[model samples]
Target: MIKTNYHTHTTRCKHAVGSDEAYVLAAIEAGLDEIGFSDHAPWPKHPLEEHFIRMHMDEYNDYVQSVLRLKRQYANKIKIRLGLEAEYFEDRMEVLKKFIDETPLDYVVFGNHFHQLEINGRYYGRYQKTNQLLEHYEHDSIAGLKTGYYKIFAHPDLFVRSINQWDEDVANMSRRIIQCAKEMGVVLEYNLGGIRNFSHVDLAYPYDPFWDLVAEIGADVVIGVDAHDPEDFLDFDSIARAEKILEQKGINVLERLAF
Candidate 1:
């Protein structure tokens, strides 16, 4: 009975599909009580001339206005909140903090996609079976949670995609991450986007071993549609399966985000 999702994306992210308004309509039709548009946040002064993963700094206002407009338009039908999915690049965190401070965002979800910056950093999902990547990922994750800026950690087991087999090191890494999230009281998102898009890929996210640790540790958990397209909200089959899995594991999914 999870009625809310806070990890939705908009077309501004470039890789995502559907209009902002269409997402609202789809969520309403699918019976979601609330939805948050957490499209990827564009970094200021990023080294790349063009990054397809996120919107440019210049487009920030239009993104905000569009979500705000939809929030108003769908007030009676559904609840819409404004947010951004951002990374914790240690060097550029000051800029990120400033951007968040000046914006009208309701919340921010932590997507530990890269080691640091997308331009020069390694993608966490495509790593070697080495401890270095895990070290970096663990470092970034803990540091980001310590900031208390991000409410939900999207795809916390994202590092599992790197290795072919799960081992003790991976288990210990999972424990540290799960324990940190529990200590900080941050929500760990079971991202549906992983199930929808990468289920067939070689990637191993939505990884069961990581979630088993989550269930054992009793960390806060939530399901993120991570909706790139509006129609993603209507995939009740995947949602049901995810809910049943978490529930069977004794993981109590949060029905609504306090935000």
Candidate 2:
């Protein structure tokens, strides 16, 4: 059974909803042992570029404080952690490293969402299907995990959302990425948010072929609620669906994170 989720979000990200406390309460109600609030991380100098998807730099302190407060308040009820769902922006990684070094974050999940930078980078989910896109996605995914900063890789097969058909390129990319994560010991998430938001035919991630490759590679995985709302934590149907599918695939699903 999956008892912990580290891919949760917050209102600070602009795209997620629910009070920070509500998420904790819901998780507790749902019998979760631990939960990590990984709201979209903010860049140091780029304040307003992606405010629609992430929090502003000014709101960073409050976001951290909120999670810390919740962590303390509900210490006995549930294990709450402070974290960020960050994209590995190669150029400003130093800034991220400096910030992580300075903050009290418990973990950071690498969300390989964009090509290079969200400021002008292509959104992988909405890209035109091409080998170059797959190559960039593959390259960035591997490089980000090597950074040693991210504990989990969120939606590793997210690049497939743009493609209509699976081919050798997709299969090879999936195999290499899965093998890389296994070697790095980074946890790959089977994202429930994708299941909740998009139909089976619509969302490419939690992609069947990709997950099949994970099983074949013997890579370990964790099921992430990827909760955008408190109600999302209560969506037992989607959670069960993910659990059933993962079980059927004979995947190695971790009930809790190692670190």
Candidate 3:
């Protein structure tokens, strides 16, 4: 049901399992008109910065070059976007600026996957253990998500994953996030991947709050397969489920997303 997709990983991520061309070709077969490559940005990982599922620098650069080449070669048929899944650590803004300078990028999406999550902390996309852990991380990511520069917040309801916080405080926190994003004009991600239950835990709606908030504020919504493999290009079926949920919430426009 989606003509475009903006989130996917190539073989460059190493943990991901697909060739750059294979991903694009699969999108074409799936009838996607646009595709965006948002590999994890290269970060200086430390013990303090867990959840860092990244790849080697050379592999990342090669992946970008390869995809850009493919994009140019295949431009007549489909649209291709080059971007990064940059972590949001506001304190690292300078570092991020350097990263942006280092890599040729078209757009950047923010994902808060870290332990400290404070303005000065880093994100790695790992899960936490308890309610306290969730609260702490959520606070940190909330700070990161406030940046007005990000084109889209990758998974608006990320707390459901790493921390699974669904208390009054968490709910209040989620609402504030919605408010901030709306004020800033940042697009909220439907995170079609929420349907997969990949957290190995039971969450009724992994990305519910973000979508719910999108509905409440009439904010723009984008879909992401968060695909790491070729087969995932067909993730529309899962996204359709999320789309239906969002429809029930009053946000009707499911804008096509290409990285």
lDDT for each residue of candidate 2 in 140-212, tens digit (9 for 90 to 100): 9989988989889998888878776888978998899889988998999999988977755654777888899
Give the clashing pairs for model 2: none
Q: What's the lDDT for all of these models? A: 0.86, 0.86, 0.68
TM-score, cand. 1: 0.95
lDDT of 1 at 196: 84
For each candidate, give its TM-score against the true structure: 0.95, 0.95, 0.84
Off by over 4 Å in 3: 47-52, 116-135, 162-165, 199-201, 252-254, 257-259
Worst 10 residues of 2 by lDDT: 43-52
For model 1, what is the alpha-carbon lDDT of residue 68? 96
TM-score of 2: 0.95
Q: Which pairs clash in the backbone of model 1?
A: none
What would the per-residue lDDT of candidate 3 be over residues 1-259, giving only the tens digit for each residue? 7787788887666578877888888889888888788887766555454433666544666867887898999999899988777766555566567656776777777766555342223332345345465565556556666654467777767656544445677667677777777677666776666566553555443556556666776777777878888888776668677667767888855566433
